[model samples]
Target: MNTQDAAIPSLDSDLADGAITPIDRPTLHSVVVSRLRDMIIEGVLLPGTRINEGQLGQQLGVSRTPLREALKVLAMEGLVELVPGRGAMVCVLTAKDVRDMLEVLSSLEHLAGTLTCQNASDAQIGAVRTLHDEMLAFYRSGDRLQYFKKNQQIHSALIVLAGNASLAMVHDILQSKMRRIRYLGDQNDDTWSGAVADHEEMIAALEARDGPRLSAALVDHLTRTWDRVKDAI
Candidate 1:
């Protein structure tokens, strides 16, 4: 077996061991989509790299049908590009694409900050604070991947707090596109410190329920983040 294929856990074995339950069809599709999305975002599958359907299917321990379906979903999300006669490749973002996406993301986060401050329950805000603390711990420990994941969770929580389903859906799509670039931005020590400071301001604004301040902070944060990552993109 190939290295990638060998690395995959057997689904049947996992199921038999009660490690993974037999999910419904739709849920299984979602799982496949999530796995492929993560693989791309984490750089396991590099940008512009052509996808090998057979090898990937073996690596993921999924059949060809579900893998193809998952690739379609990823294509719709702009994480994969389907080229005629060339099959699918991971999407490569141009500098302009990054700029455009960050602009939209900044606006969305601004709205999220405004609505979250106005609408989020005390419990929800507290939960976000807890997550922020956990993220900080990851940062302090120098666990970049874990820190990035928790950072993502905090942003997602803010969207959830905004209580707008449409906003949440749009934000998720854009966020997926920017994940890898943002992760790379944090690799610089100065930029990473600045991001942590920005998060601190975000938490403070949330705690004070200052909608306008939080909105401004979110916009400024995203702008500076783009500044840090633009050259790399």
Candidate 2:
């Protein structure tokens, strides 16, 4: 067998060894997409790097079909570029791209803040506050990943509370592209502290049901977030 073929452990062997059980094709496809997405967001597939389909497929123990489909989904999410002749490359965001996305995201968060104030149930707001507190705990414990995950949950909860599916959809699309950059920003002590403080303001605004204050705070928070990452872009 070729080196590449030898390198790929058989799925059947995994099942025989009780390492993994059989799963439906759809489930397998979803797993492939998620794995690829995580790799991209974690910078395993570095920005502007050309995608090596053969190596990637072998490493993933997945066929080209599922890998290709995952690439298509990532392309739609603006994480990958499909070059006609050269195949796929990881998308690199320019400074202008970051600014443009942040601009639109700022507007979306502003609208979300307004709607969340007017429409969110007390329970929903409470949930966000709980998440915010949990995120703070993680931050204090120096668990950056868990803190960021909870931070994202707080933001998503606000979007869900906004009662607009279209708005949530657009925000999710833009947010995906910024995930890595935002994670990097969270590594900086000053920026991370500022972000935590911003969340405190957000929770306060929500508790008060102050739509205008929440809206303004979101815009300012997002603007400052961009400021933290702009130099890196």
Candidate 3:
């Protein structure tokens, strides 16, 4: 071997036996998508408003390419409509639309609750507990955005813990589309407190591994969610 080649260390052992876990960091495109999702959910980008790509690109400090890509992602998530020549527009969900999706979601979550209570490992339940604690902290601090994010995470975790990939896939699609409407469900102090209380019951049921109780809690929560947001719609 050449002298320089001999001096260089081999990575064969490290490649085969490395113990370091890979970090899962969000990509720039995903970050942009998340910001746009938050804006829509919080009503900053009102429904039916045309997305000004250039303006948003500048505001977000990203070039048009990534911004457009992010918009395409949002379109797929049903949060935006892509018009032929008019660009993207924020999607408007009618009361019927919200009701229909929530009904379906309630059913899906009902199944998930029972399955999760039966199937989730202790560590999986602990992970959800951690998310719940963080969500409570955000609620206490009056950080609505962070609280909502954690709230969504907890629901997603429940579906995931059920161990049904097909159910999870369908649930995710509906959940993504309903995010903006769902965010409005707890807009006031009274409704917010009610929603938080509902979550407390859910967590208690989950920790106790009571499938029937968790299923009932999930259904009740989604049913009340309609009442909370229907007036706004």
Provide backbone clash counts, one per model: 0, 0, 0
Q: How close is candidate 1 to the true structure, as a TM-score?
A: 0.80
Candidate 3 regions exceeding 4 Å error are: 1-15
Q: For candidate 1, lDDT tens digit of each residue in 99-211?
A: 99899999898899999999999999999999999999998999888899899999989988999999999999998778888887898789999999999999999999999
For candidate 3, the TM-score is: 0.92
Per-candidate alpha-carbon RMSD to the true structure:
10.5, 11.5, 3.9
Rank the models by lDDT, top first: 3, 1, 2
Weakest 10 consecutive residues, lDDT, candidate 1?
20-29
lDDT of each: 0.91, 0.88, 0.93
Better of 2 and 3 by TM-score: 3
**Candidate 1 lDDT score at position 125:** 92
Residues 77-163, model 3: lDDT tens digits: 999999999999999999999999999999999999999999999999999999999999999999888999999999999999999
lDDT of 2 by residue, 45-133 (tens): 88999999989999999989999999999999888899999999999988888889999999999999999999999888888888988
Total backbone clashes of model 1?
0
The TM-score values for the models, in the order shown, are 0.80, 0.80, 0.92
What number of backbone clashes does candidate 2 have, counting pairs of residues 3 or more apart or in separate chains?
0
Q: Which of the two candidates, 2 or 3, achieves a greater lDDT against the reference?
A: 3
Query: Which candidate achieves the best TM-score against the true structure?
Result: 3
